[model samples]
Target: GLNTADLPAKVLANRALLCSELGLADQRIAAAHQVHGARLRCWELDEHPPRFGSGAERSRIEEADGHLTHAGGLGLLVLVADCFPVALSGGGQVAMLHCGWRGVAAGILERAAQEFDASPVAFVGPGIGRCCFEVGDEVRARFGDVPEAASGRMLDLRAVIEARLLAVGVRAFEHLDLCTSCRSDLFFSHRRDGGVTGRQAAVAWLD
Candidate 1:
């Protein structure tokens, strides 16, 4: 999930530059227009050979919120501003997940966990943590008893996510301890920036 943030006018321009800088141009550089959900799409470094869903450019592969593949070269992507962009890999495969509160409540982690059928290394990316995610009671209830907004309430969403992953047998993981709202100087923050904010994309692939 790469972002078209302050990089350049063309998303792929920045993408191409990034790949060059990171020495990933030889690999399959893949990305998508994300819609927060539990949907999964797979891609490969082959001739896609068709128009896209919106009938735009003929892409090299498919699109969805999550992506998994065994192909050695295709890079997996997911975009985020305040959502949890996760990267998991094991057994010569990798998966990238875009999980917001809705996706989390819908058990996106569980979905990714199920993909392994055993276990995998999960990487939870930087996003709006609970400290900055002040929501009304309705948002809390969606998670089934997370407590009221209780006014000016904030939870450690990182800790919660770790627990969620662990509960599903994901024993190994790494978290980029970043909060968009708290560390606005580093990453984009939609909440703190008042909705008109740019997104930061997270991506991972095998070397």
Candidate 2:
């Protein structure tokens, strides 16, 4: 339970422990405060350095929904409760994105795909699926052109994400269609829990 909602003191400790267990040294992990926007942060090993986790200098970088790096062994982390955590990799670079509906609509995945030198492979991790994501007409309208994205206000965010990535030249994709709202035994769902819930971590790195 890597809770990103800034709870008690033990939350940071939990994150530190998880990083150690995953072999990602505290100083070598990078994270960001997700703003549900399409902002992307590009990191160069030498210029950006590592910037998150439980060390002295560790800090979540600026507000961004996506983080990309060419540095191997440096983990890029994103926390999600019901939002999708999408990982993209190709051409010696990797990116981890916190793709909530707002971020997807803002073209976050497309931006990440364009950053790659070649067509990147994508892994769309678990999130609230259309089966449980009943939204209002306004939200559903955002994805009007994506055939599979909406069904009578039930927003299929994953479909929208896939369509966007494909439009941006991403050729390969793996999707874990687990719905966070329905799989209560395995995931924490904000909507299911009425807006208060823990988060799961999605970490990506090369090597």
* Number of the predicted model whose TM-score against the real structure is largest: 2
Give the TM-score of each candidate: 0.81, 0.92
Error of 1 at 132 (Å): 0.7
- Per-residue C-alpha lDDT of model 2 across residues 69-162, encoded as one tens digit per residue: 9998888888898999999999999999999989998889888888888999999999999999999877878888796778886888989899
Give the number of the best model, judged by lDDT. 2
Residue pairs clashing, model 1: 1-77, 1-78
**Full-model lDDT, candidate 1:** 0.69
Error of 2 at 54 (Å): 3.6
